[model samples]
Target: MDRRNFLRTMGTAAAVAAVSSTELGAVTLGKDKKKKAPAAETGLRVRFLGTGAADWKGPDDRGEYRRLSSVLLDNRILIDFTPTDADMLPEGCKPECIFYTHSHADHYNPEALLNLGVPTAYLGKTWISKAWKGFADASAKTGVPVPEIVPLAIGETVVCGDIAITALPANHAIDATEQALIYLIEKGPTRILYATDTGGIMGVAARIAGIDPHVKKGTPITGLIMEATMGMGDKGDEDYRLFTHSSVNTVHRTVKMLLRRERLLLKDGESVYLTHLARTLHPTQAELDANLPAPLKAAYDGLEVVF
Candidate 1:
């Protein structure tokens, strides 16, 4: 609802960015296996079900299928929806909630939304307007009423089950060519940032003020899911990209802005998962993987991760 109320609802924060606190952090590596525990005690199980998005090949491409970025947390809560081949769906997989990071065709595919009966949230104005305009067409094919369109205001938080999700205005053109959204998702003691469709990090640091500046990081966020659409090296030259998207170098600089400034954190072995890739960009999965300091991995469709 309102900003004040929303922050209160999150209960606690992870300015320190630690695990064993957020939904994503519930994931235990091979050795952490408790003397063994029950499913409930383990917490929500998140899995990467797909790693694909529209134009994975290019603008003209539809879906030849190598990857489509989509994640199913405990078989519900889809991070981004893309048109994916039915064969790629994980066995017995079904999502209950869909959170759109932006309004790009790659992130919100009309075909994919057609089959889902669950409600979805649009965290940005660009995405809200685009989806609302197409509501009629999507409803007709699905035989389901248009989804309950929840309009999220910038800096507002919503409770999804046990998770508290907040939207931060992401940098993307609101013009006809594109519409977009980015998110900061939190649960219990963990905080997770889902940022996509960014071109630079300077403005992002200024807009992400909702994150309480005092909270220690590792205590809250167990993980970060960011974009690396561009590659390494100096990005000071391009005027177009600077205005609309972030390159790998920009992403790195942004990360430093947060972690170094204590806005986010990195545990001794904790990690950062990169998703929503643009293959045409300079940062290839190999490049991001090989160059990142540590605990970083390329996110693909169907890839599930813990905070």
Candidate 2:
């Protein structure tokens, strides 16, 4: 799509009205909300609808399995959508928006997105044109009108309801021209870092999470849902997959550094969950829990948590 057509489609008054309906009128959440507030008063609900690497394919003999990686926040915003996620959504659930991490098949499925009937889908500005073409072709085949595609650059923030979502550059690479992303989500006093399809925390994300000491610190992270695609079994720093996916040691070291810098906010003994696990490398959840260190738990397909 060209610039004029893209702008005309995305900036129309009807599109704006559809997007505006997502804004919560009565919900008021501020950064200064009392730390001691009740859970129902200051918490964001997150459901892990799918949590697996690219290699996962349905169920296995051990009765262990996972679908493609995806997350639903407050049951309104989706981090990613996949074809397999249709069966995972709650009954009568209707999401309003979707924020993509990249264009990888595991993270972005045009059919699943169009099927959701969401009003808006946010993507990185560098690849929105390509994304528009893909969505247009899918819509032609499926008879579903394409949702508005909102292009966002790194560091850009968009407000949906009382939530503020900021995009951060990811350390992963797909091709020469595409840029992957992680997100920093905030609601009231709760802040969450959703990092997936990325190797490690990039410099910009590290600075924003207050984990980089040389730069000005930003806010502390309340919860983290990160990917560990390159499992911990026998992978080392020299592994080629480490460049695009995180391993066990990588997550552990990063979390330790963040803790030392006081960049993570945990309440009532909450732990960070690891998603996008590889079926071949990582063991069952029982074995994983026995092996992983404190505050790093394995995420399952139906796991839900509040932060």
Candidate 3:
């Protein structure tokens, strides 16, 4: 009904609000993980948990929750926590580490955290200039002593125990008020950059694929998870959605720029995964695959990959 009440209610359960609201909330992702999903079956696993471009729902209404926009990494690291993220965290996938590139309706999963305790002791995404203030506000309210916001710059690293994360700037929205963050995660030979809820990176995205002076230096792209949100055109044209969000061709351009021309360092065999699809373009997975560049696939809910 109200902001405070809305936040409080979301803290209760994934479907608590849906039951009361006319427009259903997110679908529910079971809390129980099926299997450990061995490397062979999982293959650098990355579960989409909800792949809708903007609106979210339970996949198939099977009671499985789709998120606004979020990615659970290695079953612990969280790229973003939309309300649906709570529904996406199928059992055995509760995240221990959380990283927010920016604070937005979909990016900030306050309710998701309430469903699973807020990760006050992890890499938090907050303002670069007002880091301490953000931490204090969180602490003041949640009473879950906030962790260091780790004010991260485009190339700076946010180390969590053994994991190293880098935050990059991106234009978050078309309306042009909110700023967003793109993240680069590294642990040994595997490196991942998570970009969502924003237009495709234009300039530095190519450089990001190149050698980084701070990181392992020349690590090539082993795994990449991008967004193919506007795969379909607007108003059901199947070709118009291209202008608003990145699509198959857009991804091809990105890969060509990052991998083909730059010759950026990458492992011999790397898999690039794309998420955030247009509901209108419910293309067969095969059809979606045929359009992407080499080693790229559209992301789906509950897709899991190991770095």
* TM-scores vs. true structure, each candidate: 0.71, 0.87, 0.65
Candidate 3 segments whose C-alpha is farther than 4 A from its true place: 1-47, 59-66, 90-94, 121-148, 174-177, 208-219, 232-244, 262-270, 281-286, 289-293
For model 2, how does the per-residue alpha-carbon lDDT over 242-299 read when each residue is reduced to its tens digit?
7798987788888887777778767767988899998877888889889898789999
User: Per-residue lDDT for 256-280 in model 3, tens only?
Assistant: 6567533344566756677766555
How many backbone collisions does model 1 have?
Answer: 42
In order, what lDDT does every prediction score? Answer: 0.55, 0.79, 0.53
Please report, as a residue range, the 10-residue window in candidate 1 with the lowest summed lDDT: 28-37
For model 2, give the 10-residue run with minimal summed lDDT.
28-37
TM-score (C-alpha, index-matched) for candidate 1: 0.71
Best by lDDT: 2
Ranking by lDDT: 2, 1, 3
- Clashing pairs counted in every model: 42, 0, 29
Candidate 2 lDDT at 144 equals 98
Better model by lDDT: candidate 1 vs candidate 3: 1
What RMSD, rounded to one decimal, does every model reach?
Answer: 9.0, 5.2, 11.6
Which model, 2 or 3, shows the larger lDDT?
Answer: 2
